[model samples]
Target: MNNKNINRETIIKFNPSQLVNLPVFLLGMILIPGLCLLDDLIKLYLPSGFIPEEIELYIRNLPVYLALLYAIYLGYQILKISCIRYEISPEEFRYYSGILSRKHEFIENYRVKDFSINRPLIYRLFGLGNLTIYTSDKTTPVFKMEAISNPQDIYKTLRGLVEQNRRAKHVFEVD
Candidate 1:
């Protein structure tokens, strides 16, 4: 008999930490073979033997180089995802992120009004979402979380706090 239950804290991500595009990867895979086909086609078409065969060969090989360059570009684009981490405590919710330069933001619990989820078609298809937060403070963000995962849960949690603050009448960020 085996019975196991592990209790873990709720980890919320308002955005995706990594990028994934199966189609782009697949396109690169297909392009690898297509380069050879295109090179052969160019070789067959560059007629008359007037130009040096070496020059023709170089021209024919250009597609392979182009395909390799495009693959590199795709890799760079897909690698642009930045990680977002949020820690929600009784006092404040803190957000932190940086692929290079670290940035941190803290929002007091009481000033929060509500949070809305934005799931455009691209996000929905790709399993990504954003959280837009409403707060009393004039700070930009109006509270925005991007590329986060499990946004619906974060939205619900933030919304629940609005009513909780209402009952407590707590004032946050007095400055």
Candidate 2:
């Protein structure tokens, strides 16, 4: 008999959606191919035997170099997003983020002291904010989630869970 029953269900799971804008992604996809086509059109219209062989070779290969550079940059962007993940469960909040190396951190709900949402001007324009979690945990005292949509809702949900967990654990903050 094999039993894989996970007791806890995820309350919320999210990535950095606000950081990956559809228009920006589409623009990047179009820019390279458009530039290559423009290079081809320029070569076609040029006067007969005007550009020297070395210069022509360099010009013809310029698009390939540009494409390679863009590919490397885009790869980094994809990896940056792929490497970060945030999960909220009833008992704990988890953060996973790294590239080539991996770091996973969990803060129990009872340890969470306070959390706040900060929306800079640009993030406000995009309807996104950063969630900052302050915990009593020694390893990661402050954890931040950037470019998350509707962070206030998440903060309220998290605050409720924290209170519930603290009650269950019989932990009370004394001032």
Candidate 3:
């Protein structure tokens, strides 16, 4: 593409939805209670002296420990999702990710081979979808934009950009 046609301005920028962590959150909710119940069952069925006091104490506090760990994990999941950012310009797609360290990736628009959108039942309720881009870029052959809003519109815009970029770059896919 000629320098005159280059547009560095970002056309679309988005971060994945926090709702993607729903399953992990639900599992933690169920697991903590289940662990407490199991501890109670063990106490009720076993003789008082059958298990050592230290072991008994550990069993009794297992749920609290697990809950703390789960909380940390959930926080990490939220942070990880928040750190991911995607940007699409007319010429290329940019992906930014990392919690402690930042990583930036780019795929030229002309390199995009195909696109697919997946809207799961849960995601559909929230008007969110996952967009997968199949690209010729070797660094990232398949890129997924998970749990983003208004994916259909983005898909259409990207499809047009890809066509335009390919024509400008004189790139033709044989297959």
- Top candidate on TM-score is 3
Off by over 4 Å in 2: 1-7, 18-67
Q: 101-128 in candidate 2: lDDT tens per residue?
A: 8889899999999887889887888888
Q: What is the TM-score of each predicted model, taking all chains together?
A: 0.55, 0.68, 0.85
Candidate 1 lDDT, tens digit per residue, 90-132?
4466777665677788776677866778887767776678778
> 1-175, model 3: which lDDT tens digit per residue?
1112336678888888998899998998798888788777866776677789998787767767877888899999999999998888888989999999999999999999999999999999999999999998989999999899989988998898899989989999877
Question: Candidate 3: worst 10 consecutive residues by lDDT?
Answer: 1-10
User: What total of clashing residue pairs does each candidate reach?
Assistant: 5, 0, 0
Ranking by TM-score: 3, 2, 1
Error of 3 at 66 (Å): 0.8
Q: What is the C-alpha lDDT of each candidate?
A: 0.65, 0.80, 0.87
Q: After superposition, how far is residue 45 of candidate 2 from its true place, in Å?
A: 21
Point to the candidate with the largest lDDT: 3
Per-model C-alpha RMSD: 6.4, 5.8, 4.2
